[model samples]
Target: MRDLIKDAIADLKKGDGFIYVTADGSKIDLHDAASKGIAVTPVNPKNQVIKKLEAAGLHLNDGKFLNELNELISLVTGNGVTSKTSKRRTFSDAEKSKIVEEWKKVEAAGKKTKAAFAREIGVGYQTFINWLRG
Candidate 1:
């Protein structure tokens, strides 16, 4: 990852604007290395500098832009980024089975009325209908 970050820095120093593709197929504007605070005057690649980052396992993907610049800088400068953590719950096997079973019943009913399906599953009709479409 460090190698990727260093390569990005080198590219940025060379006056290249990083191109990032958003999940929705939109492009992101990442202008320059100087703007991102990664020094690149004269824009030359340093082998020793790259080696240090590579050894530390810091890497970024091509065209990801400076959204991760602070993180990379923290890795290189020994002061990593800090943030709060949160826990998330995944659906249990029983829950998954229930949803599938509900879907089956909804299909088997033949008429497939929104109200009927919602009543069968004990959820709001609108919510059940939206879930079906989603």
Candidate 2:
């Protein structure tokens, strides 16, 4: 049983899917194993399907096995881990000083709060505060 489970995991790692046959002869398809939906089953501690998969290191939540499966899928599909990359804006020292000076003027005039000023200048409130601190 352990060997079977290990072999299944190995196959998944090699970008191949398998169908697990339960002791009762029911079939559980592990196609697209990287997907959470593919691993859904009733939370029964004695469910052979779930038990075997869990024993093989597959967890419903994010876990090492799932990560491996995802990596394999990414390699096979040519869609590596999808991450959102934001373009960071860098301000020069002169630009920073100028913005700070303008903020000071606004502060003296009591026209707008720092958060509003930050919004007006297209920066986050926390980022603006950090700039001011610097």
Candidate 3:
């Protein structure tokens, strides 16, 4: 609960860009598994920073702490997150054509996958695929 944020900060600073399984509590930090929640909300690993966060409690936030959480979430999840947010982003037809054309070069190079490219362009795989549908 407490050490979570600092551990996350450390994890973020490492920026290895991979989140591992936390259920076993081995070889992975909470933020490392930020999958969607951007939370390591399970481990109560007795981190000193967590203890400090508890001691300096705001007493207003029910239970959640960290004004820095938002920044942390963005860093952890950012555009690389696997899931999409609720809102739909509309792209122009020209933009769609451009993306599809670029993907052609990437596909020809065989160095990357459609999914990876879609992530790079900040679009979902399905959305990217739909552009190629026609």
Off by over 4 Å in 2: 1-86
For residue 44, give model 1's deviation from the true position in Å: 71
Q: What is the C-alpha lDDT of each candidate?
A: 0.51, 0.63, 0.60
Candidate 2 or 3, higher lDDT?
2
Name the runs in model 1 displaced over 4 angstroms. 1-97, 109-112
| lDDT string, candidate 1, 1-134, tens digits | 65566665664574443344334534334344436544332312343334546566543221133235555676789875544332333555577467657677657867666575555444566665565564
What lDDT score is found at residue 87 in candidate 1?
32
Candidate number of the best TM-score: 3
lDDT of 3 by residue, 1-134 (tens): 55655664665455445444444445456554564454333433334334544566622222123324444576788843433343467999998999899899879989788887887676888888888996
Best by lDDT: 2
Q: Count the backbone clashes (under 3 Å) in each candidate.
A: 4, 0, 3
